[model samples]
Target: MSVGSENLPQFALVGGKGTGKSSLLESLVGKDFLPRGATRAPLVLNLRKSDCQEQGIFLHRPGEKIHDFSRIREEIANRTVILAGLVRLSLDCQPDNFVEQTKSTIMEYISKEETIILAVTAEGLVMSQALEQAMMVDPEGARTIGVITKLDRAQDIAMAELDNKVVPLKWGHVGVVLRSEAVKCWKY
Candidate 1:
């Protein structure tokens, strides 16, 4: 069964490049459906609650396209679907960056009732800068939440920086230590 876009609450996951956005989504949706490489354009994962499966992915570039991946897990029946937001471009892109544009688009989709998760990695200072820019675009960050990925790779210095709250985020931080994988997914 397919759920219309209007009925669900959009839950976006915004962050800089290589912040483990796709990996987080795979963990949440309980499948390795989404591609971990750079997203070329915005895409919507059509998730259905009753079936506990990802029905299709609605790609937003080169016109809307749909792809089906059949993998169902019974454990997701009781859980609901919330839109996960991810930008198709890097936050540090030069010449013509799409971070601002993407944030604006996401702001339009989210209602006053929904929340947005900001994914940040503890490996660099760039994550903090990206968060600040996001806050500027969506002040109040009223419904924003921060997820700090790559806790396992954080060094003593990086851990100290995080502990000091060097870059203050309004919604607070939740650290996630992803298990080491053979592929070495993170790119900078």
Candidate 2:
């Protein structure tokens, strides 16, 4: 599926730490129309000198503190970018005073930005409570895209179950499955 122009789609890579959000980011950058040898080993957005002229990939590593979002906010305000490895701060407590603060933090980061893509951890979605918190980060419907990573682990999750999650993927969006388990249908 293709991304629509009308929508300022925010792509989120939602999964655990090892779910390969970083690897996927590399893949996307590699696929971009970068000038030869412009891509660097460690992930960094060298937009002007970037080999990929078509797409701009920026990653915001906001340390555990929500206050660290200033750096990310600065980048959004400065230019057009596609953020990867973008994660939401996951908290367990009923932050009495911090809830609004957290939402405000996210809104501030998202406000007036031309585009923002989020990479999330699936662990946040496995339960109702976590899902609610996630909803705060990504509302019920916000043109936000989700990708569940780390299927390689999570024993209870079968390949079939994993397939179900992807089938519901919004058109033009991708729900990437990490590994392909051999299916028995072909030979029989």
Give the candidate number with the greatest TM-score. Answer: 1
Candidate 1 regions with alpha-carbon error over 4 angstroms = 1-7, 51-54, 57-113, 122-129, 157-171, 179-188
Q: What is the RMSD, in Å, between candidate 1 and the native fold over all Cα?
A: 9.0
- Give each model a TM-score: 0.58, 0.38
- Compose the digit string of candidate 2's lDDT tens values, residues 36-88: 22121122342222353333335444222222234433444443223122234
Residue 115 lDDT (model 2)? 33
Off by over 4 Å in 2: 1-16, 31-107, 110-119, 122-124, 128-134, 155-188
